[model samples]
Target: MPPTRRFRLIPGAVTVLGLLLALGVPAARAHGVRTEVLAGPTSVVTVTHDDGSPLADTPFTVLAPEGAGPFLTGRTDAHGRVAFQPDRPGAWKVRVAGADGHGAVVTVAVDSAALAAPATGATVATHHAHEHDHAHDEAHVHADAHAHDHAHDHDHAHTRDRWSGAIAGLLLLLLVLGVGGVLLRRRRG
Candidate 1:
């Protein structure tokens, strides 16, 4: 042979490569909470762990626009979701806390338009409760209206309207997850 050559791996170079790989990998996210406003006065709340997995059985409280105490209290289901309807229209606050002191608060506003609008082709039940300033007596009005859009179709639209909120919330959650995944992939590359 006219010439001989030898090559050796450098420890520093290997270490640098390992560090790069580690930095490129996505780290687990911290525990967080997310909320979405569904149709009408309904809202969906979700709690997740660091890895984006659902945190079930978490307790949550909802405060009305004007109240000294919580208006509604419940725990998240298996999918880390809890649906609640605000008693009155205005700004509603939802607070959730984990056992480890991890918690979040979400605020949502409800408008009169949403409350006044009735779902199409659905039975309507309206209840109004008013407290008189001068008297202790309270006025209550309960109106139940059942209307059929089409006689041939017996399908109920109220059921579908109720689920629409849930479906919307789920879609929002999926969208957020998808965007987060894309960002992580981009960073890795």
Candidate 2:
């Protein structure tokens, strides 16, 4: 090709290269959805894939017996477990799902006895009933605090993911447009 024609190809080539790089960026994803609920004073739900691998960082919601809305929501831990203390005794629903569309909705039965039971130190305090009760109460408070922290962390992560995706898309669009503008100016001149 002539010198002028060859120069115009450089802008086009750069745009193609930018597009390839942008397309190669990996996106955040949640990709599994099976659940097992171990109910007691505090219900621990374990989410995994059909192949039995844990679905780490996946989102989940705990619905009350009335089902007005989600009583609690958070992402699973590295082991794919999320625990919640049900306030009232009844049937509570736990929904574990991912963006990839695999998830399970489990109904956990909680009785008044479970709610009345102490949360921890059951084996250590066989003789001191009062100490056991106090220990349980303390453990319950700790679990609530931890759950609240998890919820906050999930919110932060969600906001960060949204902003990152938007920025990536905007940068890609600007890159394409800037390259196109350069080629157009060269052709006109």
Candidate 3:
């Protein structure tokens, strides 16, 4: 093949490789999730994916400040929610595990004042403590099905924005490729 012909295939091949890589990126990524807490009459915890989907029916364990073991153990409801009544004011830890090896530990700080005024519909502050943040490594099992827990003062808009950003990125990639193709054709013809 002539030098020009051989080099002509380069741009097309590069574009093809780039497209393949871009398309495969999402599929190769592992799913990530986060958690939120609502402290009211009962301390409620909500677990959700970064994309804002509920992780329904997932198992959760709540550890009280005074206990060596779980204070309450159960699976999240369809909305990824589980609740526990704190007997005392302290830091309560809620560990939620998904089926696919993903989970989060949320630390909720409960005050005596908050517990005392539960009738006021008060919400408690929650701390994000991921599995990696643990002092010791603990083996966890993830659930395949989805579970979602409802809580107060949690926003779902962030998830929608994330999806929009991804779509915008794909559109931008297509625009760049189109312009490149046009320039290449103009150069040849």
Candidate 4:
């Protein structure tokens, strides 16, 4: 046999490694998000590629402010544009698709007030409401859009959120088992 093994890993290093692994796993799966608001009779939300190019022909859908919706399905054009026409004069449910390597779904406002007012004037420009306006369209959201792309629109964030949580839990279990194995080895030694 070669020289007796003298490998040592400080407890602090192990702790740090565990923490880093726990944190890194989530961030790695975290998806990019973007929303664009076109102010008009029908406010179109264009979900772009990460490269700022269009997301062409991606299947998408939209709903009205109320929970009642046989959803209006759409597909992104060559320009990555999904034009949604609000069924009624109120806050509309704008759900876009994510996780197909695209991005997250989002809710946006569409009505006489939101559309008639140019997106450049009083509020849309100042508040960036169109870009980051969750508060604007939350209260009027429909319950049916829960399984779609628009992040704030749905109760279920995505299928990935649930699976991610399960994987993290399993990782914790494995880490515990690993630590137990180490302890058993040390005791035997």
Measured by lDDT, the strongest candidate is 3
The 0-to-1 C-alpha lDDT of every candidate, in the order given, reads 0.51, 0.64, 0.66, 0.53
User: Candidate 4, which segments miss by more than 4 Å at Cα?
Assistant: 1-31, 98-101, 115-189
User: Cα miss at 71, model 1 (Å)?
Assistant: 0.7
What tens digits encode model 1's per-residue C-alpha lDDT throughout 90-137? 877778788888766766566676445442111111111122133110
lDDT of 2 at 172: 90
lDDT of 4 at 163: 49
RMSD of 1: 16.7
Q: Which 10-residue window of candidate 1 scores lowest in summed lDDT?
A: 135-144
TM-score of each: 0.46, 0.45, 0.54, 0.43
lDDT of 1 at 79: 59
Query: Candidate 1: where are CA atoms >4 Å away?
Result: 1-25, 30-32, 117-189
Best by TM-score: 3
lDDT of 4 at 114: 58
Q: Per-residue lDDT of 54-117 in model 2, one digit per residue for the tens?
A: 7879888999898687999999888777788889988888777889776777777887877777
Q: Which window of ten consecutive residues has the lowest lDDT sum in model 3?
A: 132-141
